[model samples]
Target chain A: MTPSKQEILSVAAECFMEQGYHATSIDDVARRLGATKGRVYHHYASKIDLFFDVHREGMARLFAAVEPARETEGDGATVLAAMLYAHALAVLENHTFESVVAQGVQMHRFGATTPGQRSTLDELIASRDHFEALFKNQAAIAKKDGSLADVDISIAVKTMLGGVQWSLIWYRPNVDSSARTRANLAKQMVRTLIDGVRTRAALQQDKPERRPSRAK
Target chain B: MTPSKQEILSVAAECFMEQGYHATSIDDVARRLGATKGRVYHHYASKIDLFFDVHREGMARLFAAVEPARETEGDGATVLAAMLYAHALAVLENHTFESVVAQGVQMHRFGATTPGQRSTLDELIASRDHFEALFKNQAAIAKKDGSLADVDISIAVKTMLGGVQWSLIWYRPNVDSSARTRANLAKQMVRTLIDGVRTRAALQQDKPERRPSRAK
Candidate 1:
């Protein structure tokens, strides 16, 4: 029996993560899905289409997971912390797809195997930018509210994003660790990240230190 | 005449970054070096050997850049800020090799094409761990000094390290921006990241508000 589209993507993500984009073939994906080439081709026009679809699905999943937190009523710092925690969990749960999505931008830059789909690339970039903007706006609000230090928003945003994204590299799914434990680990990291950017005034009524002096 | 080993490694890094480890071969490296295959073979037994050497050099460069700050006498926060900035600069300067090195660990995990080089892989992992320990120790000290909020040191260390390493993905050397300008950008980022985990008490004598409740 032919597998569903979701089933195909799940198997395909595993293949791409293991063997990489260039090495994974449509036939291999079909074989993994326990379906024929005709069944696979019926769903995806080509291998490139399949890869792009994986990228899209990954971004969509991220937005779905975090967008609700953006709508929650809270101070900017509160919202950001919540959103980052959600993002970290999503990454851990959907690592295979996230891995492909992470490489998508780099692959696009090299014009590797991605056919003339500038619109698709733009759409993906736009989605990514929008996701970042959510954090950037909240960060600015946090600064304005005196909860965050007066730091460059771009730098702050990227740093936070990087930390959450990096979890994919180190988080391994094993029988020993429960999903709750992994989620808690991600939560702690997100708290550290959000706490890092928060203004010192919030904690100690102390003056916020800019850059510390380098000892000669 | 054959190029030096250093020259060969440089070209090989470019090739691997562009074409990937599986796709790039020793012959390709030789062609890029404008030398015969024999010359390439004389210095390296296989492409895997060259890759391991690149990983070693990248780790060495990172240690060279950040280790001095570890010994500096100052507040732990100050020392950490200095070390992160230096590490960022090292990443930007040694981007190509660092890119390859970043993939090296992931490649090893998959047991992909890396032949009986368990010792080399273990050595690289040890170096990576040692480098991270430097940051981990400082973060712990920062917490003890009351400069940082009481948070998990492992989480803080990985978050900071991830932000610095992410620069390799986005930073590009260009005529439009001078090295100094790029370095300064990295510095600003490092400052924001270090400040993120710091205890607000260290910065604010003014008791800033925490968790601003959302306005209904």
Candidate 2:
């Protein structure tokens, strides 16, 4: 049977994540998919096309997962929690694609992309910025509502998002593959991040100076 | 003027971090250093040697920055805070070297290294594991002391460390280059991470049920 475009892209993402862009070739993707080179070529004109498609799909999946939470009607902290949960789940579930997204981001940052790919790189970067803005907007609201700690919003948001995305580096699907486990882990991660940024007032009603030396 | 081995390693690290291991050549390093290739060749036989040396130096710098804090006389929470602060500072101050370390880790995970480099990679991985164990040991002690939240220690350590290391991706020394700014940023980051994992009882004297839905 002819492999679908989605299948090709998925395999390509896995290969790229495993071997990286320069090391991976069309033959590798085809071999992994158990399809002919012609099969992959039918879907992607070149390796770069396959890579960028995977990158785009990764971002699309992220937006799909988190946008609903951003649109949810709730307090800033609540919305932010939902978004964080969704993002963590996506990272765990779609590890390969997200890994590609991360590689693409790093490549762009370090000028690893070819000049011809500059436009696509820019568009992907813009999408990433837009995704970050969603969290930043909610964080601003949370800070105003006194739900978040009085930390720099940019630093807090970047650190929290970095923590969530860093799962790509440490998480192994083969280790804990159960859906319930993933959901629980996601919830725990979101809670830890939210609680970390939460205002001291929200965490306790008294004894603000418990850790006097470290207290802000 | 002859460039010291230390100077070569630093410049080589910057080159490796910016252009990646494969793209960077000895000539590039030489040109960047305003010296001939012979100078670099005199200190290091090949680019691989330099890359691995930079990786070693990065790990050594981290150990130097963090080990003192781990050995300091304090509770786990305080010790962890100091360690985290030291780590963040090391990452910011030695941005190029740390970036190389991160790249080396990724490369090692992906099996990008040559067969000959396997032993070196193993040694570096051991160093990384040892570093993580320090944080985990402190976290366990903190948990026993009722300072840390009741959560999975492995997940917590990985997620927290991931967040701290993720600074490599987002932090730009050119943007906020001042030592004072870096120190302040590091403190804030450490606080957010420490606060996030601290037990509610530790964070507050009352009102534990305020966010009941998220409460463990």
Candidate 3:
């Protein structure tokens, strides 16, 4: 396929992801794209601009994947399952950008940014907050309904988020086995978290270590 | 007061934490301690040496505080409570080294290290794995007993670790309100994590946005 603007973003993301935001110069990104400095500048004003654009593109992809299902008629469990599935898939297929976003988030935290970067970061954060609110409310509704077991929605939300964020530590999507493993891992997390995996019913259905203690 | 070796490590940790490991020079640290380069180098052979020493010292303080109690005649919940308390105290007090350790660990993932740094990092990581295993076993035993509710031990362990690691982001020891606030936060995490927090439980038992959840 011809290198469109989206294609350029993809290539640039790889450079930023590999070399880090500050270390990656625009000249290198342009060269990687098989384009010149002027062409790169025409598309993106600065290195930081491309970095934020990549972040924006990433967040948009994430939100696009989950947002519709969240608005759908699915139950909380179904919706969370869909969300986790999409997230896990993204982690598997998009290792470089996924890792970049995680590290860039830390850099963004250190209060060392140009005004342009900060403004873009602010918008990115708000977008994330909006995304999180969707999950929180979904979990909250699940708690209210009998679909979910007893748990704090607030902390549960955090755990769910952390589970996704921290997985960048070990998630390698290039391998086929990794995809299934990650998908199962995420699905299992939802099941155990929302349904209480060690519930009396599950205990009764288990082996000794996995047995349920509450079923009379 | 005359600066002790402990004082030197403490001050060095602060500089490393604020300025980052590669970014900080020993001279900057010496200046902070009102000591000359000779004194600092005498205590620590090289910058890497100094960084590793502080890292080990912080880890030792952490393990020391939590080890005795876990080995004592306490159940997992009790032991975990002790560990969490110790952990929060460590983050609040040993801010510098923990920050450097966090940086060092991040650097490790990218192969950004000499052999000495990697070896020391391996040691630190092994110890951390040990702590994680300790918590995992504690949770497992607690789950088997009636002391803690049934949940995935892995999820709980990661969240507990994430909570402490994240404290490096917002934990400011000089702030008086946060001291009480964080202690309670740590305790609340312990409570809800091992045992499910009933909706009827005190609201103070849960904090807002434990780990960047989507709470609106």
TM-score of each: 0.87, 0.88, 0.73
Clashing pairs in 2: A196-B196
For residues A83-177, what per-residue lDDT tens digits would candidate 1 score against the true structure? 88888888888888998887777676554453477667767878888988988888887777666666778877887888778766666665416
> Which has the higher DockQ value, candidate number 1 or candidate number 3?
1
Model 1 compared with the native: what TM-score?
A: 0.87
Over B16-105, each residue of candidate 2 has an lDDT whose tens digit, in order, gives 888878778999999999999999999999888899999999999999999888887665566777788899899889999999998888
Pairs of residues at least 3 apart in sequence or in different chains that clash in candidate 3? A132-B214, A133-B214, A203-A211, A203-A212
Q: Candidate 1 chain A, which ten residues in sequence have the lowest lDDT sum?
A: A197-206
Candidate 3 per-residue lDDT, tens place, B95-144, comes to 66777766656656664677877888888878767877877887687676
lDDT (tens digit, per residue) of candidate 3 on A19-52: 6665678998888988887877888888887887
Model 3, residue B67: distance off in Å is 1.9
Residue A98 Cα positional deviation in candidate 2, in Å, after optimal superposition:
0.7
Supply DockQ values for each candidate: 0.38, 0.37, 0.13
Stretches of model 3 off by over 4 angstroms after superposition = A1-4, A11-19, A27-42, A72-95, A139-156, A172-177, A191-216, B1-4, B27-39, B69-96, B139-156, B167-177, B196-216
Model 2 - which docking category? acceptable
Best-matching candidate per DockQ: 1
